[model samples]
Target: MQRAGNAFVDLIDDVFDNYRQFQHSNDFQQYTSWAKQFKSKLSHALNTWIPKASAFVLNLLSKLRTSMTAWWFFLDHPEVPPDNNLAERSLRLAVTKRKVSGGSRYN
Candidate 1:
């Protein structure tokens, strides 16, 4: 059971590595190719029967499969960000600033 879980995690890590590579690489053709290959590989991995697949992993994979449309948005819009890290960070910073300002009791 542990072995099956580890293998599933490794496959997921591979997918994430491929995604990060695609995100970092500015080549449109390469990203498209990687995305197609990643989708195929992930689909195959998800289809494989694991002896003791956890519900969490199964649900995660289901969510990923359903979010395919948003995954490849970068292909159509080169300006689109590959991840939401920047936006998330900006929001965090805004919240921090607001909290600090509110606590400071500035006019």
Candidate 2:
């Protein structure tokens, strides 16, 4: 299970690396090609690993499978990012303030 998780992370990392490279070069065609390959690899991995996965991993995979289209939405739009890091970062300060203040009485 650990090996499978590690391999899945590695695959995602590889795809992100390739996406960055293609983005830098402004190579839409290359990105499209890589996206197709990624879809194939991801599908194969899910098929192969999900069957052997534990309950926790199976739950994770179930969410992933259902949200698969959202996951690859960035591939269809050059302006979209592959991750939500920027949005999350933007919310960090607000979240921190809310946590520090505890619950708001008005809300």
Candidate 3:
């Protein structure tokens, strides 16, 4: 029984390890894409948006960049952006709370 439990635990850990690796790789690829777009946008912002509303436009762009990096997007018909930030933040908070609470009985 103990060995079986241990094996199950190890299997779960392996699955999580694989998941983390895959997530990291996928995130890296997305970040590379965003980086390319970021360079172009920076140049465009500097040339056009900066002179007119430097602070406001730059701040908005900064928020947009954060949302982009976080995979934020609307789920409506048109599917806008900057929507996932709250969900991601809440997930992190829940994880933290779980750690503080010494995990759930099911886990």
Candidate 4:
């Protein structure tokens, strides 16, 4: 995903990072279809284009665009977090405790 450019990768990154925020929407729909449609476009691009490299790029770009569109569902939902920052920042509590104590399981 990192190889895909920041703008393109951000959507999937947000999806995985902030899945809870987009699981549901004000329209009473889930984000599942967005992901599904994104995948379908990628598949079609790959299958339709004869040149493999061009097809792959076209697919990736298309998927990235669709994923970004899916992010709108998050904006539509007022109850969900803006991003995954809520959960991410919350994790500091555990990390701080670990630092104060001996450490995590590995540490």
Per-residue C-alpha lDDT of model 2 across residues 12-105, encoded as one tens digit per residue? 8987898789879988988888888888898888888989999999999878888998877876775788888999999999888888999444
TM-score of 4: 0.34
- In candidate 2, position 26 carries an lDDT of 89
39 in model 4: Cα distance from truth in Å? 19
lDDT by residue for model 4 (1-107), tens: 33334433554565554455454443334555554654555445434442433556766655644674464444445365546787889998999999898786662
Full-model lDDT for every candidate: 0.65, 0.85, 0.48, 0.53
RMSD of each candidate? Answer: 4.6, 2.5, 19.5, 8.7
lDDT of 3 by residue, 1-107 (tens): 34433543554454345335544575555444554554455445434543344566566545644564343322111123223466888799889998999888673
Q: What's the true lDDT of residue 89 in model 1?
A: 85
Residue pairs in clash, model 2 = none
Error of 2 at 101 (Å): 8.4
Candidate 1 lDDT, tens digit per residue, 1-107? 46656766786676557566766886778766776776676667656733235787667656656785675465455466556788888789778988987854656
Query: Mind sharing the TM-score for model 3?
Result: 0.27
Specify the highest-lDDT model's number: 2
Ranking by lDDT: 2, 1, 4, 3
Q: What's the true lDDT of residue 87 in model 3? A: 80
Worst 10 residues of 1 by lDDT: 44-53
Error of 2 at 5 (Å): 0.4
Q: Where is the poorest 10-residue window by lDDT in model 2? A: 98-107
TM-score of each: 0.56, 0.80, 0.27, 0.34
